[model samples]
Structure formats: structure tokens, C-alpha cells
Target: MLLQLDCLSTCLTSSGSVLFPITAGGGSLDCFSACQTMGYGQILHRHGNEEDRVHLNVGGVRHQVDPDMLLRFPHTRLGRLLLCQSEAAILELCDDYSPAEREYYFDRNPRVFLCVLNFYHTGCVHMMEELCVFSFSQEIEYWGIQELHLGPCCGNWYHERKDYIEDGDWDIRSDDQQHPSLDSSFEELSALDKDLAKFKGAWCGDLRSYIWLRLEDPGHSTASKIIAVASLSVVLTSIVAMCVHSMPEFQRVDDNEKPIEDPVLTVLEEICIACFSVEFIIRLIVAPSRRKFLGNPLNIIDVASILPFYATLALETADEEAAEENEDIENVGKVVQVLRLMRVLRILKLARHSIGLRALGATVRHSYHEVGLLLLFLSVGISIFSALIYSAEREVEHTDLGTIPSGWWWATITMTTVGFGDTCPVTPAGKIVATLCIICGLLVVALPITIIFNKFSKYYQRNKAMEGQFAESIDFMSSVIISTRTNRYQTDSQDVKDVFFSRSSCS
Candidate 1:
């Protein structure tokens, strides 16, 4: 008796049934777990070419659907609800069916691929277990009929046009009665059921729909070169102006003893500042928000340059006698000087603003591990050089080399070949140590410098290659857009000419 009960339970489990009653036009409960186990993809039912949609299958059953017939039914709200979670309101009117009914339907209908029972939900359908040809292969020895129906369970369902299903009055039993008989010639149903059973299907939505970003094209990269050159000029000139102010040479220079200035540098500085200032204003206009310009690094640099210039003009014009009485005017010069020097860091914009320079910066950052290794070796060399000099000069020389830190200064000078010649050893032993230290320092320093330069050179070459590729890509895209636009204009030449003249007149 226990074995018989187990067999019955297994048999009942093999047949698909509606787990819940679908309410009419309410909403769809997710069946993603069940759908995935089935052979098909997500159940989307919409009218039109939905080739990209995921399909679905019933568990423990398999069958191929007719493409033409599938197209005719297209997609239903119930299918779409099951697949994409769309058309939720439409699923509120459908109802669900019981297990026994589903088993009978599976046995009776060979053509029945999926049976969906409608509950009270208007457009939603609760999918019953699917029966395909593959499921039939496992049930070859069984004797049963697969009869399927999509009808209401218990409520008084009625539809004026399509409302009867909600009232539970719509009967699909007659439709089920027309299905073919299942094969059941032998006893053991377990083997056939195990072999024939398949899992439910799920829906995978469109991939492109997830992407919403619309980044503006960088435009001709030549534009970047122009902007970068202009920005660098503004930054460099401001830096030099600050440097000249700080340096003794400029401070000491009288009007009569002024050095000749380069006319080229002067013109370049003016041009750069003017171009960058204009660019900044244009960017501020295009910015999504006014605050965005203030927040942006480049925008801040532009504003800083203009602000100092205006502030200087204001401070200079202030009452000269009053300014002389107060030291505030003198302090303003120092603030102006600092503001000017900060412009040099704006040269960083060349790397940050351009894709080509950004790529180069990435390579430089990536090579840091190798650069660190070189630094480590240099540290070791510095220690060794310091020790040698200290050992040779500390005993009788009574020099600064008596300390490690003091000796390191000599090591640094020797390593860099700066050789200021401020400190030299008089002892024979100290001189010999110095000579050997200088030779070792040259090789040790040269190794890392060579390695670093080689890495930089390689990166430069790669960047040039990438720039060429980028240029070609931009050129192609520009040609396509321009040609397309030109064709459109030629097709409407009179309209184009009128619009162009009107725009010219307005300007």
C-alpha cells in the first residue's frame, strides 16, 4: 500500500497543474523559477515580430511549436506578464486551474503545447504544465489521455465580450474532449515519466534597453590639440609671470635696465589666455547646470585666471595715498603672485582633457611597480655610498660626512653628477673613496634613468599609434555625418538657403 501511494504521488507530480488561481485583470505573480527549469525561454505574448523574446516550456514535457501558428497568436498579455513583467494590469482578469484537470489534458491533447487557466485576472493566464513530443517518448508504455482546458475554476465568471472566463462559466472541456489519446500499454510509468520530463522556460529581456547613456562625441580631436595648446599657454604664461615676480632678477630690474622680452612669448601668452577665457565662457553656457562649471577643475582654472587679473586692476586703482597708509595693498601683491603661479598646474588639463593624453597617463600609472623597483635599488645605492664615505672621512677628516645624513648629501650630488665641489676630502683614503663612489653612482643612477626613459619612449610610440587610429575613426564618422547632412540639404536646397540667410541676418 505504501509503495502504491508513492507511485501515485510520483505520477501526480509528473503531470503539470496550475499551482494558483490567476485573478482577472489583477497582476502576474512571478514564475521565473518554474520557467527557467522548463525547456523554453520567458513567456512573452505580444503581436508582431518578437524574435528577440525568450521562449518558455512546461516541465516534464517537450514539443516544437509551429512558427506560423506561433506568429498568428503572437503574444498575449499573460505571456508578456510571465516573461517581461510588463502589462501587469492586463493579467488581473485571468484564473488558475487544478492538478487533476491538467493531468487529463496532458493525456488527451497532443497538439496542446501549454495550457493556461484564467482566474479573476483579466489578461493574465496561469500556465499549466506543458506537454511536448519529448514528454511523449517517455510515456510510450502508459495508457492515458492528455486533455487540456483553460477554464475558470469556481467563481461565476462571465464576459459580455470576453468576460465569461472571470465568472467561471466559460467551459473549455469540449475543446479538451477533441484531443488525442495518450499511449498506456504497460505498467511501469516511472521510467517513461523520468525520461520525458523537462523543466519550465523563462524570458530574457532586450540588452540594449538597459543602456541609456548618450555621451556626446569628443568631436575632431584636432579641437583637443587646439584647446590643450591654448590652455597650456595660459597656464605657463601665468606661471612665468609669478616666477619673475618672485625671482631677485625681476625684482631688481629697473625700467632703464630691463632685459629684452621675447615678442613671440608675449603674443603666445595673450592668445592662449584669450582663447581659454572664451572657451571657458562657452563651456559654462553648455554646462548642464551653472554649479557644474564652478565644480569642474578646468572651469575653476579659467575663473581663477580671470579673477586675479580683475582683482589686480581693482587693487591698483584704489586710493594711492590711502593704500600707502595701509599695508593691505602690499599684501595683495603676494596673493596675486600665488594665484598666478597656480595656473601652471592647469597644464595637467592637457592630459586630463584629451583621450590620447589620458591613455598615456594610464600607461605611466601602470608602470609604477617597475619604477618602484628602480627606486628601491637607488635607495640601496645611496645607503652604500653614504657608508663608504662615512667610513673613509669620519676618523681623521673631521668633516660633515661623520653623520649618515650629511654623507647622503654628498651621495646625492655624486649620483646626480651635480658635483657642486663645495665639500672635498683632503685625505688620500677619503679622495680614493670619493673617486670610487662617483664611478659606482654614475652606473647605478644611469640604469634606472635608462629604464625609465625606455618605458616612456615606448609609451610615446604606442600613444602616437593610438592617436592615428582615433583620428581615422573620427574622420570616418565625420564623413558619414557630413555626407548624410549634405544629401539631406541638397534634397531641400531652397529650405537650406532660406534658413542659412535668416541665421546670418540674426547674427
Candidate 2:
């Protein structure tokens, strides 16, 4: 049970050391904790009233329950109302700091002391147990020297010489081949050529000079080359693709029209195919694994476009009829031609790379249930509209109401309210039925969309409220921790000053 104010007392006794003064620490710093020295078994057996003292032996110290402590620290009182809620708040505060800070704090005090502090201030002993369980490995031990572990101002003191500790003289270069040559044999060079060559060969002899050269122009060699090549390739490919896709052949050919044997078109296709093949080859060669290349969607697209053209030549040598049949196959050689359409996907790719898009994607992914509800509602509309169209359009015989599948085509068009007139209800009753179906379709389609949007709005509002609550909690915790630490520092400083005066007097 949460300790309510039934009694109040303060003991002024000198201890081993003062972490904080009993008063004047400012802003609720004088607050004390209620403790129970008796075990749960004893409390259960005695069944004492709320006013009765329960002397609990926590660690080696016997602490008497002071009901007034709960009144002083209201957070503790509320925390005792729900252990898990208090536990969550403590965990959130702990997350703001690192595991190293918790470890350092736990190491400085006894387990029971931390437990008391947690239960009294945060009202959670489980959090204290959690902090105690984390192991301090060598790397964590090293990281423990940072601001999270020590004073924020003492940052450089701990981190300044860490590299030396890990490995002294570790960075010394052992191979001369790794360095470039300084002396250029080509003496008759222009000013720009001379400057470029000098820069390239600057990292030649001394290790310190090489480090300085790299620091000044990091990624000097490979990065510049990659940027130049990528930019050139993108611009050139886009221009070429625009010209190719815009060609007269991109238009639909009549079914009865004979195939055109245009040498110019074939030559252009061959060029594009060769370029795509070379791109695929380079990707395969440069990639760490062939499996990685095969897995890439664009790489597969490139391969599909180019590889079949090479196969046609082999087919031509084996059997002329097979080659002729391959050439006759509609859209067989149009794979490279389709690449122009893919340029529009670049915008989507850019969005995927952006932080805003990532946030949007996460939001959408989290709201999948709402999205699914909207989709299901749309699907129902489609199904009902399709069934209606099939029933209504079945009598329109000469108007190409061919079958149920064909009726569905008309249904899709009608439900979207597209009213294409490519297929329509011919009879008077069918037309009346179509009009009523259209009206109903619009309402049915909107229902799920409205529901989904409403749910999403509620979800967004709830998240915003939670975010505000979290921010306030964080600010409150920060004030408490800073006040506690500052008080501790001041008390320690004063003790040191008293000790120094005493020593001088003795001397």
C-alpha cells in the first residue's frame, strides 16, 4: 500500500558522508523516503494500522516507515498506486541517459540503497533490479568514461587519450607500395597537369604528410570518378531513352500491317542492347557476389532486355525458321524500349531516400488496418457493381455483352462511374438499373474511405497527446535529477572545505 501521512518525523544524525543536506537543497530536495523494516510476512501477520511503524531491515540498515514521505514526494505516492506505470517512467528516464550511467550509479551505492531510492522517488524496485543485471563488458567499461558516466564538463578528460590506450603506434604504415611516387617522368606538362600530378603524388614518403593530404581532400581519387561517371551516365541514358521512347515505332501497330524491316530502327535497338549488356557485365564484375546481382530488380531488368538479343544470333545459326519466329514475336525486342517508362520511378526512389518519405511510410505501415478496411470496402463495391452489371447486361446480345467476364469489364467501368460507352446497358430497364447501381456504388465506395480516414485521425490525435505527455514527464525527470546531482556536488565541496580547514588548524 502507498504510504499516506499518518505520522511524520525527521532524524538529524551525522553519517559516513553527506550526499545532500537535510534542508535548503532547494525545490523539494529536503524530501525523505518511507521505508518498511519488517518483511511482507511480518506485515501480513501483525496486520498493523496505517499509523503503525513497520521497521523493515532493508540491506543492513533498519528503516522506520515515515508516512509523511509519501506526502512530500507525490510522484512516489502516485507510483505506488501502479508499480508498472512508475516502472515505465523510470525506464524512460533511464533511456535518456545511457546504461553506463545506471551501472556507475549502481556501483557507487548498495543494491538495497538503489532499490530504496527507486521505490521512494520513482516507486519501482524492478527498475533497480534491471539496472543491476546489466553486465559491464570491456567496451561498455571504456564507454563508461564519457559524459553519460562522468560530469558533462569532464568529457575530454576521459575521451582525450582513448585511442592511445587501444593501440599505440597502430597507424604506422608498413608498405611503401601503398604510397604514391613523387617524381613524374613527363617533364613537358602543362600547369594544370603539373598541379593535378603533384596532388596525386603528394602522399608519397612520410606517414604524417600522407595523413595530412588525405585529411585535406578525403575521397580525392575514387569519389570524384564515381560522381562524374554516374552523372554522365544518368544524363546520357535519359536523353537517349527520351529519343527512343518518342520514336514512331512506340505507337500501336495495326494487326493486319506487315512488319517493317527498318535498318535504322534495328541499328538503334542493337546499340541500346549492347550498352545495356555492358552495364550488366560491369555490375556483375564489380558486385561482391553474383547472387547479389541476380537479386537486384533493375539488374534483372537490364539482363532481360539485353540477353535475349544475344540469344537470337545463336538461334539464327541453328535454324532460320526459329529466328524468324522469334522476330515475329510481338514485344520480344521491346524490353529496352520499355526502360524509358522507368525514368519516372526515379522520383519515387528519391522519395524513399528522404526522411519525410520514411516517416510517411512508417505512418502508413502502422495504419495498415485502416488502409485494409478502406480497400475491403472498395472491393465490396466492385463485387456488387460487377454482379449488378452481369445481371443487367446479359440481355444485350449484339452489343458485345459476351460473357460474365466481359460483363465484369463493363462493371468496372460503370462502378468507377467512368461511363466509357464502350459497353453500355442497351434495354430501358437495364439503363434504369445502371443509373441506380451507379448512385449506390458511389455511396458504398465512400463508406470505408470515411471510416478509415476517421480512424487514422483519431490515431494521429492520440499519438500527439502521448507525445506531449512524454515531453512533460521528460522535463520533470530532468529537473529532479539535475537538482539531486547539484545538491550532492555542493555537499561534497563543503565537506572538502571543512576537512582542509581542520587539517590546517592541526598543522
Quick one: best lDDT, which candidate? 1
Give the worst 10-residue stretch by lDDT in candidate 2.
Answer: 97-106
For 1-507, candidate 2 gives per-residue lDDT tens digits of 212221112211122111333444342232333213322112221334553433333334444444334333334322231122222443332222122211111122234343444345443232221332223113233222212433334334434444343222212122123332121112212322332233332333233223322221223345434643553454356446545655677533446683443565556556655655565575454343457447654455455545555665554344546566664544534543344344433333322123344334434644465667666755776676667666766666676564667766766667667888887777776777678768866876676566545544544454445434433543453355457659989999999999999999999
Q: Which tens-of-lDDT digit does each residue in 1-507 have in candidate 1?
A: 443233223322223222333434422223423333332112222212454222323343433332333332224422322332222232231222222222111223333323322211222222323433334323321211121212353112211322433222212232235332121112113322221121111121111111100111233455555655655565667556645555555444337784433455446555656666676675554443447337654456557656655555465556345567774545755665565555555555455346556445544554565567766866887788788778888886457778878878887787667889887666798788788778877777777677556646655665556545544554564465457658877879988899999999999
Please give the CA lDDT of all the candidate structures.
0.46, 0.43
lDDT score, candidate 1, position 488: 74
What RMSD does each model have against the real structure?
25.0, 23.4
lDDT of 1: 0.46
After superposition of all CA atoms, the RMSD between model 1 and the true structure is 25.0
* Model 2 alpha-carbon drift over 4 Å, by segment: 1-46, 49-261, 288-294, 321-379, 390-404, 426-507
